[model samples]
Each structure stands twice: as structure tokens, then as C-alpha cells.
Target: MDLYIFCRMVLQQKALILLVTVVVAALASAYAFLVRPEYQVSSVLRPAAINELDALNRSEIYQLPSGDALIKVGASLESYETRLGFFRANQKLFKNFERPGRTLEQSFEEFNYNSIKLVVPDAKNAGSLNAYIKLVMNYPEGVAGVAILNGFVQYAIESQRQQIAADMEVIVRNRLSELAGRLDSARSSYVTDKAAKIAKLTEEDNLKRAQLQDELKALRAQLKNQRADQIAQLNEAIGIAKSLGIQKPSTPSSLGGAGVQGSQPVMRTEVNNQQIPLYFMGVDALLAERAALLQRKSDDFTEARIAQIAKELQLLQANREVEVLNQRKNEDLFLSGVQPLRAEEVRLRNLNVDMSGLKLVTIDKKAIDPLGPVKPKKMLLIIIGIVFGLMLGLVAAFVRGTDQSRRENSSDTTLLPHSSIPAKKALLSNVEAL
Candidate 1:
């Protein structure tokens, strides 16, 4: 339609349009003020600082980095079970949500699905490590939005903290058990080796003692035979000296010079270049050596080897290594490898930390009561209502004006005079006028 005609139609129903606009606008205003509105309360969390996680990271048994801590906190916050648990624990805070038709679980589901939201850094972005996570709660008015938000945040953090502590405890306990097993194995191995070595030493000493005994016995027998042979030779020499009537030791030269008394004392040549025989030593010296040989008791001193064997046998009787090993009171002290394992065990045992105090996340912005409700944009709603009312009123006015004009035309036709003419001619005339 042309602007003039459209304006005329609108002005014709100005009162109706005004009333409709006022009613719609007033309804929107009332709804905005009277109905319960939802407020948005949020808390911003970031990864903990290096210093804040120092206690957990410094531990040898377990380590939790800042990024990992943040991830864990976020996971706990986003977990459905965790949110449901929180809702169940603090039902009083959500009492307004519960009514006759809605069950507690349904309310919690609505609350979890709609009211609560977790905003995290986009995974598509690479540098999201330093990004903070936002936990938002859209709670109705007078529902303690601030407390619910803060309380859930604290609950999620505490839940994650307990999980970490449980994990750390399990890790430390398993490690300690492993170390204990290793230590026991090492000690057992050490004892086994020591016992084997002692047994080997004892066996070797016994074998060596047997060998020395055999050698000693052989040497003593040899010395006894030599003494007996010496005695026999001395006795033979004594008999020879008695037959020759030589009681004292005599050189060969003296024998030649005194030969046969009356024989010619002519120049007798005496050449003694060879060693003298045992019989030439004389009957008295032979008899004395034979008597000394017969009186001898132990022949151990006769041979130098026998004395050496005796001394070695005495040494073998007391092996110093075996003695030291057997005399040890604490074998653990002697285990070299077991020391490091024990030290590690001690270190782990001393790391019995209280993770309750450990901080996981840093709160960048704490949840607080919002200044105004986020829902029910009053101005926008009021404007929409007015526009809708105006459009409806305009359509109604246009239909009414069209119907009035049609009625007036119908009445004008009825009042006009009726004249009879050729049907074809009248039809043509009417057609031409059209």
C-alpha cells in the first residue's frame, strides 16, 4: 500500500492501537518485575603457581604440576557426579527449585544442565595453558546464588584434593612395599652369598689341611729313613775301624806313611785330592753320631720342608675371612646394595605429607551477588510487545475499512434505477466501463 493510505488506515484505529500497545507493554513490565528472575554469578579460576604447588611437587613419592592441578580441578568441576553430589549435600540452598510436580533429581538435573556451566579454554587453541576457567551459575533471585557458586567451587577443589591425596597415598604405599621386597631379596641374596663363601672357605681349608698332613707325614717318614740309613753307615764304619785297629780319625797320607812299620821308609808319595769316606772319620765319631741318631724322638725338625708344612697347617686351622664372616652380628651393615634401597625407603617413609593443606587452584574472581538479573530484559520485551500490538491493530483496522467500503458500494448499487436493454449490448457496455 502507498504511505498516505497506510497512514490513514493506521490513524483511523489510533485509539485501538494505543490501547493494545499500552496493555501489552504493561503486561511485559509486570512480568519483568513480578516473575522470578535469574541472576548470573561466576567464579574465575586459574592454575596454581609454582610456589603454591611446591610442597606436592617436591615430594619424591608423588608430583603434581601446576597445569595438571588446574586440569584436575576443572575435571572435578565439570563432572556430573560431582555436581549431583554437591546438590544433594546442599538441598536447602536449592529449596526454591523443588515443588510438587518436580522431583529433587529433576531439579538437580535442570540445575546441572541449565543453571551451572563451566567455561574453559578452547582445545583448538594451543596457548590455553595459561587461560583461566570460568564457573558460572544462573540461579533464580533470592536463592543465594553467590553462596552456591562459591560453595560448589570449594567443594570441587576439596574433592579433587582428596582424590589427589588418595592417589598419592596409594603410590607411596606401593612403592614402599616394592622397596621392602627388594630389600628383603637383597638381604637374602647377601646371606646366601656369605654362607656359600664361608662353606667354600671351610671346604678349601679342610682340603688344604689334609694335603699338609699328607706332606708332613711323607717328610717325617723320609727323615726317619735317612736317620736309620745314617745309623747303619756309622755302624759299618765303626766295624771297619775296629778291624783295621784304627781307634781315631786318620788321614790317607798318615796311613801310607805308617804302613807295615818295618817297611821301607823310602819316599812314599801321598796324593789326597778326593773327599774322605765316612768310615775314615774314625770309630769314636761314628759311634757318637749313631748314638745321637738312635736317641732322636720327633723327626719334624730334621727336614726344613716339614717345619714349613707345620706352620702352614697352623695357619689353615684359623681362617681369618671365615672367622670374620661368622662373627658378624649384623649382616645388613655389610650389604652394600641394600644401603641405597634402605635410604630410599626411609625417604619415602618420611614423606608422609598432609595433602589437605595443599592448594590446587587460584581463584581469580570470587562469586558475588550480581547487581541485577540477567533474564527478563524489560526494555527489549516491552518494545517487542508494543510492536506486536501495533501490527495486530493495523491489520484489524485495514480489514474493517475494506468491509465498510464494500457495504457502501453494495447499497449504492441497490438504490440505482434498473433499465431493460439487449442482454449482449448491456454486457458489452458493462464490460467497456470495466
Candidate 2:
């Protein structure tokens, strides 16, 4: 019933009970001692700053995302880890541990794969501070299991930084190159256009010169025709005078005096007169008139032609001047438009160079080694062992108590008391003999 009574009964049969208890307890302790200890190692890491986002913000490219902090952090971490060769290194770890069932490499791989934990501390401290705390906790020697975890974390961070720098450099170089190429193309096009414009202007100038020459030629031909007409008229007048036999009047004074004495001055007639003297005089007068008209027309035509030619030449010169000015203006515009682009390209190139230098100088923080074992906490293991041993001892005691009770009950049932027995038949027979 009581523990003392039960223990006493077992002690009375102490040899067997002791033997069973010793065997059971020994086996349990042995099993507990033989069991492998599991160690827990942990390291903390915070996501790296997103340089791209920073750049975008600084450049005022676009609006930032809403309060999706987790998504943003995850995306940033993933991008950062990828740059750092996290997956590649993980694959390598997996490959190295390849074996039939189990191996050290496999163990290590499991530790790496399973040991990582990501947590956001609080809403108040979001990016930088949270990352910092995570970094501190993950430091190699600072916390349990942190040392082993720190190596991978360091590798991941360094790898990420290197990758980011590389990507940035490549992007900057490509962009600068594209800008440079575009600037060069623009300059070339501008030059070609300017050349074409100048050539067109030259062609127009040549055409204008030819037109002026043609006008001059037409004016000269018109003058020559007028002179020819005047000559023909003069010759006709001379021929008519000769046919009329109108000789030159000799002794004009003697003919005039005789003619004056009469009512009408006697017409001084030539010996070879073909028509009346008045007709000859009229023909001569007509010739003179024709000559005068021709001379006047020639003079007027020449003056008008000269004035027109001069005005046209002035107009052509003015147009040519305007064309030259236009070409100059276009050239100036081309230079103005292209020069800034070239300068910008140069500036971008220089900035890229500086950025590359800075990237080259950047370095990752070094990892520290742990001074104590990070896993398989001894105190926790001991405490768990003690509790399990106590539980097993109690179970053994309960089972032993039950078995003893059954044995006692069986023995009592097998051995009967003398008070309950019947009187012997021999005693009755003896009484009859007496």
C-alpha cells in the first residue's frame, strides 16, 4: 500500500529485486549515455542595403513602394544573396557531401540549410538598425552556433557586395558607352547634314550665276538686233536718194537767189531724178527719223537692261548672303545641340571611373572564430537526462510493485491454514478397537 511497505517487501526478496533494478537502471543509464547529443548553433544576419533603390530615390526616378516591408526586405535579401553567390556555394556544399546514406559533408549541409532563421525585429526599427542587430547576433563568437553560421554569412555578404559592385560597374560602363555612341552618331549626322546644306547652297549659287549670265546674253542680243534694223533703214534711204537722181545741191546760194526771184523757189532738181525732190527729201527725213528712233531705242534699252541687271544682281547677292547666313546659323545650332551631349558623356565616363575605383577599394568585414562549443548545450542535456532517468526509475518501481503483489497473492492461495482441515479417520478406528 505505502512506498515504505512495498520497498520493505521487495527488500525481503532483495537479491532478485536488486538484480532486476540494477540491470534495468544500468541499461537505461547506458542507453542515456550512448545517445548522441544534438547541438544547436545559430547565427543572425540582416539584409544588405539596397543600393539600387537608394540610387533611384536619390536620382528622383520614381516613387517608392508602399508599406510592404517584408516584400521589400525579401526582395533585397534575395538580390543581395544572389550577387553574393549564396546559391552557388550552397550547391557546392550539397555536392561535397554526396554519399550513400550519411557523411560529414551531408551533416554540414544539413546544418547550413536548416540553421538559418530570418526575423524582423519590430516595426519601429525597420532596415538599418534591424540589420545591425541581426549582424551582431550572427557574429561568429558572440552567440551559440553563431561561429559556424558566421562563415557562411560572411561569405554571403562579401559575395553580395562584390556582385553588386560588378553589376554596377557593368551597367555604368554600358550606359556610358551607349551615350558616347549616340553622341558620336549625332555629331556625325550633324556634320553630314551641314555638309549637305552647304553643298545645296553652293549649287543654288551656281544656278543663280548662270541665270544672270543668260539674262546678260539676251540683253546683248536685243541691242544687236536694234542696231541691225537701224543700219538697214539708213541703207534704204541712201538707195532711194540715189535712184531719185537728187544730186548734192551745188551753189545753193545761186539757186536760192533765182528761186527767190520767182513766186515759189525753183526746186533744185538733180540730173538723175527718179521722183520728185520733195519725195527724196521726205525719204531722207524718214531715214533720219528712223536713225534717231533706233539710237534712242538702243540707248533706252541699254539703260533699262543695265538697271534691271543691276537690280537682279543685287537681289541675287542679297539672297546669297542670306543663304550664307542661314548656313552659318545652322552650323551654330548643330554645334550647340551636340556639344552638351558630348560633355555629358565625358562627365558620365569620369563618374564611372571614380565609382569603379571606390568599388575596388570596398572590403567585407572579417569573421571571428568561436572560443567555446556553440551546440549541444551541456547543462540542458544534463537536465533532460536527469528528468528522463527519474521517469524510467518510477516506471520500473511501479512494474516491480505490481509483479510482487501478484506473486504474493499466488503463494497465499497455494498454501492453506491448518484450522480449516478435516479430522483424521485413523483416530476413529482406534476408539472402536478399545
Top-lDDT candidate index: 1
Would you estimate the TM-scores of all the predictions? 0.87, 0.55
| Candidate 1 per-residue C-alpha lDDT over 1-434 given as tens digits, one digit per residue, 9 for 90 to 100 | 45666678678878877887787778777887788888998999998888998878878656788878888999999999889989999999998878789988999888888898899877778354557889988988779889999999999999999898889889989999999999889888988999999999999999999999998888888888988888888888899888876678987766656646665556656677788777777888888888888999977776788878888988997999998998999888888677778888888888866778888999999998788889888788788878877777777777776566556655555554565235545654553343
User: What value does the lDDT take at residue 79 in candidate 1?
Assistant: 95
lDDT tens digits, residue span 1-434, model 2: 46676566555655555555566556555555555533334344333345524443342222233223224433444443442345346554434334578764555455345545444467677664444223322222223343334555545445534554565567667877887778677768877876787677767866986787788777777777867776676567667656754344333333345435546546555454354333244444656766676656344354476677767767666455446645564453545466666766666565532222221111123235445444445556555656655555555655676676666655654465565333323433332232
Error of 2 at 275 (Å): 26
RMSD of each: 4.0, 11.0
Off by over 4 Å in 1: 1-5, 99-104, 123-130, 260-273, 295-297, 420-434
Model 1 residue 234 CA deviation (Å) reads 3.0
